[model samples]
Target: MNGCCYGRPTRLPWGVSFPPSSFAGLEFGNAKIHPSQLYFSLAGLVVFAFVWAVRKRTGPAGTLFWISTMLYALVRIPLDFTRAYEPETAFLSAFGIEIVESQLSSLAIALFSLLMIMRLRRESLAPSAA
Candidate 1:
């Protein structure tokens, strides 16, 4: 979320002040954008561990995939919250309320996965006694 995707162009305090090609065309001098670098790389490892733990609990095979996706999104919400906002597309204004699109999307993804997991777990636990 902090690359060319949507993060705002920022001026870094620790850098040489020069008009590089990437920043030359930009409006502000020395305002650097993320250089296609990694954001929270450790998050992937954490998600892997979470999925592994859940799988070891006898979770359904696909539950591992679902939990992985859900946990990643859950982490994204906070990451985006602290991230630099995109100058143009950071927030949506509607009904007199301003909301961050990234946060909303992350939240939606997390909720969807949680509901799916719960439904699958409930079904799996149901008895055939009738």
Candidate 2:
């Protein structure tokens, strides 16, 4: 059987409510946060497009994968900046770290890019002297 029968209903809870609000007048405290999940999903699709475009380019087997992942991370980081985050409290910690979303994303991209470059280099060198 499909999983839907076993799952709960998908509608929002009946008691929850929201006042009519516009994007411009909404403050961080009063406004609903931007949907970061949907943003990331769109970013993923963009990355897929990029990978598909680059797949046939002459370079390495895994280059497109790495590039796509890096770009996705880069996009997500900046997008996260526009989102609302909960206030830090004694019970809640953002891992005790204070990194801008873009910075973190860039770092991840850099590391993955480096790994891809190294892997490509090794692959290219493998059959050269044989």
Candidate 3:
């Protein structure tokens, strides 16, 4: 499952072959692919650590949520390129760059998070009516 869930199958560069039972779902004929799930897990840990580290320094409540959302999108947009995904019928393309469904969703989430962060920040800064 995890192996097949993400990333395209990669062929061995030096013509290396493994027994089909060697890695179970990790092998395809004579090639091993990028462990995209592991990559994603590692990236998630990194994001968590970074956000946790900065939590105390970040101003206002909910800032970390927005920051983390943006961070995930930033990493995922590039990371998804390494994975194999079905061609989207409703994707956006421009200047030779295509945005797939997952990427588009990430973008929307990040943008919405940013807007909410800004709104919250503005609210936090405004003088309170005693």
- Winner by lDDT: 3
* Per-residue lDDT of 16 in model 2: 19
- Per-prediction TM-score to the true structure, in the order listed: 0.65, 0.55, 0.75
Candidate 3 local lDDT, residue 114 = 85
**lDDT by candidate, in order shown:** 0.61, 0.54, 0.72
The model with the greatest TM-score is 3
lDDT tens digits, residue span 1-130, model 2? 2111111112333211123353222333233444444556778898888778878883777776677767776776566554444334122236654455455657778687878867886887787764
All candidates: CA RMSD (Å): 4.8, 10.1, 4.1
Model 1: clashing residue pairs? Answer: none
Evaluation by lDDT, superior candidate among 1 and 2: 1
Candidate 2 runs further than 4 Å off: 1-32, 89-106, 118-127
TM-score of the candidate numbered 1? 0.65
Tens digit per residue, CA lDDT, model 3, 1-130: 5344445566535223345654533435545655577678888999999999999987789899988988888788777765655557338778866678888888888889889889889989999999
Q: Given candidate 2, what's the lDDT at residue 33?
A: 40
Clash pairs, candidate 2, are none
